[model samples]
Target: MQDITLASAAEIAAAVSSGTVSARTAVSAALDKIARLDPRVNSFTDVVAGRALARAEALDAARGRGEPLGPLAGVPFAAKNLFDVAGLPTRAGARINRERPPSERDATLIARLEAAGAVLVGALNMGEYAYDFTGENVHDGDSHNPHALGHMTGGSSGGSGAALAAGLVPLTLGSDTNGSIRVPSAFCGCFGLKPTYGRLTRAGSFPFVGSLDHLGPMARCVADLALAYDAMQGPDPEDPAASPRPAEPALPGLETGIGGLRIAVAGGYFARGGDADAFAAVAKVARALGADGTVEIPEAARARAAAYLITSAEGATLHLDRLRTRASDFDPAVRDRLIAGAMVPATWVERAQRFRRWYRDAVLRLFESVDVILAPSTPCRAPLAGQKTFVLDGVELPVRANIGVFTQPISFIGLPVAAVPVRIDDGLPLGVQVIAAPWREATALRVARALERDGVAAAPAAILS
Candidate 1:
């Protein structure tokens, strides 16, 4: 039987639209799932069942009145804790903000989703201040990889990934800064897209690095992701960072084959020692896509290092005051990252920014010859929770920074990516990344849908699994 939890967002919308299922039914199933699994997974900081029910009832009433509705009408969703939700602290999983009062309005992204008729289920968990890569939020407790409860769930957006993977919700919002969104999606075996920086508006959400933070959808399939992405794109004057481009809908040209597309397989940093499962997954994608050629992102080592420096420095600057006086309040693991960012020299920060521009142009140059770039989302599947180190391609890595190798450089340049998961040999999840040029989320989604058609997307995760 087709699992109700595994149904794609599109299927749910159609069911609700046709009255085969009520919005209330969807919300009830999701809340029931959260209630049962969340205690073990810790994917949510709070599940607002009562509030969500009221909102769904209001939406159902409007539908009964024959009022027009948007594409996502009646769908249940969750926001990364960083996004403001009325009457919630937007604590962002940090002890630092625990005492802060409830918010006055929805973050722009949340507001947009609500306007489209998606109900806010509740706030998802995340790394404190969005700083760490592992899903262990010291303040909020570790969000287990429901895909493989023993393993980690990738960072920052870990809760979003976990909730979706554990069947708590079909759609959730997560941000990527140095790969937060994609990594979690990769490990959790779900589809996550980090639209080009600024392609989707960012106001009313908390900032991570400001330069690299990107908010987008995490879901079970590509078409549904495209639906959510279509709704989130476009400009809001309040966000100077949001691009002024018109919103691009997901319906156009989505199922086309990639026959003429030049898909490049990267060497160097991207091909190194992830687990055998990582390369195995990448191999499957290459075969399915009929990739045109292999290419190298030269100077990848330097690029990765520079990206780390830039992110650390900027992140520290963002929280300098808090760090100076309220240092003890931060998760000790991330406190060092903030401190390291603060200690870097001013000149290095500027130099990293200059290099960022140079790297962006170089990536653009690569795109001139290729339609998509393929790489492992993380070097490996989620690590054991609490461990801070791993070996990749034969080198030891600081667990926090190592996962970003493939994901960060692409995101640093404002590229849009679809983190598409593959099956795991050991019953965990594995994900590979598909990156397209700026403002090309549709292109990314199209290619991801192609992969799904080829059978590389995640299987239906069962409650028992």
Candidate 2:
């Protein structure tokens, strides 16, 4: 049972589908592990034991009836708290959202995963309203890195990262506006995919940066990330931003390998502004893939700056009422930032949007030459929990604001990125971004699969007491 808890989503599904393991057993193992290990990790904000058990029993009954199960059969997964999990309030990691009524339905991604036979065990913790890069949440106690309890779990999908690293669940759903998803994956040592913006539906989740918000899966392996991404593909009428593109199943083409594909290392901005480990991780992955070419993304630094302005402006607009009525209810840091955002001049936001379009066009042109681009996922490894500052390039900077320095520009324009963990030494693991052109998730996943096959990138579960 304990072993089942640590198995990948693909492995558990195969076992359950073959009757070698019952769905109930798989879910129970996950529940028990969460109960035992989650206290220290603080990954879960809620544990839906009864709902999970009941769903598992139903899956078992379906198997008994000779009914075919979906690809993710019997897998236990969780979502960041911003995603609605029927009967629970969509916390969005904000103190004030706790007063809202319970959600009446699951988010689109959650429902899709359930349809694919993935059971949702609970809602995980996150940074307030998805604005944070560090995973610390003042409302809920900080989510500790499973590998080193005192270290930070990258946010705003911090809990999602911690849970996978701690083996609390094989998969989790998280939203990425800037670096919410990839940052955590890098810091916590896991595989995370931020699908092309609008590739997946955002219908039932709480809004952060509406234009920039993206929701995707995080897992310990590239296979699981592809599985979840394949299952959740499709357009949602309820979400106006949902892409109209048909489901491009990444799992089918995941192992096609990166043969005959032009892969390059991202130079210039991506190459600088981090500790040695960050670049080392990218270099290790580049070597594994035989990637000798490098491409300098034009104006990447400017893009990151523009992303911040847009995020602050949009986030402020979304929470203006809350900022007006419940300012004291927020994490003071988050509140103050949002307040500052409200004051951003309209001319600045307009200029940022105009630059965003130009930047997107310039970056997309690079994809014509290279099928995939590799870059560091985070500026550095996880910092100590509650630690306020870190020195990057010999200059001290606020940990929260700069943590997403590498991730923001990529996400600023909706590109698909697969963050694969690389552990080069005994120290904390780092990640390399396998970035592809819009709607080219398979290209990124294929590259990630190659790295995994070479054993250069892997997410080994943390051994927690």
Candidate 3:
């Protein structure tokens, strides 16, 4: 069972599909691991063990009937609490959302994964209301880093990252709005893909900044990420933001290598504002990829500011009624931010939106010369849990808000980003963001695969005592 839990999602799928392992066996392995390890990590808010076993039994019965299995046959996985799971309230990282009735059906992504033969394990923890950079949920307890249990697993997809790293599950779905996916990926030492905005459906997940929120997969390896990502491709009529483009499978071309792709390191704004470990991680990947040179994306700082403004205003508006009715029920940190956002002048938001378009064009222009841009995913490795501040480049700043400084600019424009964990000698692993043009997740994954092949990046299963 431990070996089953340690296997990658792709490996698990192939083994189960070949009848080497039963779906029930795999799901039971995952549930058992979660039961033992999650109490310390606090990665899950709900573990639907009974549902998982029943789903697995159904799959095993189908296999016995000689039915065709999907690409992700018998793989066990979970989702950020924000994604609706039938019979459970979609928490969206806030206690306030628990008041909502249980969902009648799973979120579109969840349904899609099950259709592909992946078993739904449960829903993981997250930053409250997805309005957080730190995984500390004032309501649900913090999701601890698997590498160092007392450290932070960056949020709002913190639980997704922690679970993957702890080997509780091989694949998990998470939302990336203002670095939710990438930050946790960086801190927890895993592979996370934030597909080009609207590339994946958000039909059943809770919204935190609809314009910026994106749903994608987090896994222990690039292959697992690709397998899950390819399986979820397709537009849903239910999601207005879902792109109309036909499904494009990234797996077939994933290992084609980066011989013809032009890669460059992001400089200027990305080059600074980080500690030595962060910059060194980017340098190591750059050397391994034989990147051509450093290229600057103009006005990135401005773009990050614009992203924050839009996230605040839109998020506040979405919860205006809840804010008015249940202010005390909300997390103090999240509630205060939303309250302040409600007061932001509309003209400022408008200007920010206008500048966002201009900044996106600037980033797009850079991609015209380089196929991929490599940069630090987080300014530093996972910080100690509850440590409030850090010094970067001789300036001290709040830890929670600043963790996404490098990630916000890229996600601001809705570009595809793959966060790959870099191995460090003694400390927690660092991460690099392999960014590509809009809808170009293939390129980013290809680069990440290269790093993995060279052993420069890896998400090794955490050593549990």
lDDT of 1 by residue, 364-412 (tens): 8888999898898988878998887888768788888787778877887
List where candidate 2 sits over 4 angstroms from the true fold.
Answer: none
Ranking the candidates on lDDT from highest down gives 2, 3, 1
Which candidate number maximizes lDDT?
Answer: 2
lDDT of model 1 at position 348: 92
Q: After superposition, how far is residue 169 of candidate 1 from its true place, in Å?
A: 0.6
Task: For candidate 1, give the lDDT.
Answer: 0.84
Looking at model 1, residue 224 earns an lDDT score of 77
User: What is the Cα-based lDDT of residue 261 in candidate 3?
Assistant: 91
Candidate 1 residue 435 C-alpha distance from true site, Å: 1.0
Candidate 3 C-alpha lDDT tens digits along 349-424: 9999999988988889988899999999999999999999999999999998899999899889899999999976
Residue pairs clashing in model 1 are 133-155, 273-393
lDDT of candidates 1 onward, in order: 0.84, 0.93, 0.92
Cα deviation of 152, candidate 2, in Å: 0.2
Candidate 3 weakest lDDT stretch, 10 residues:
456-465
Q: What is residue 113's positional error in candidate 1, in angstroms? A: 1.0
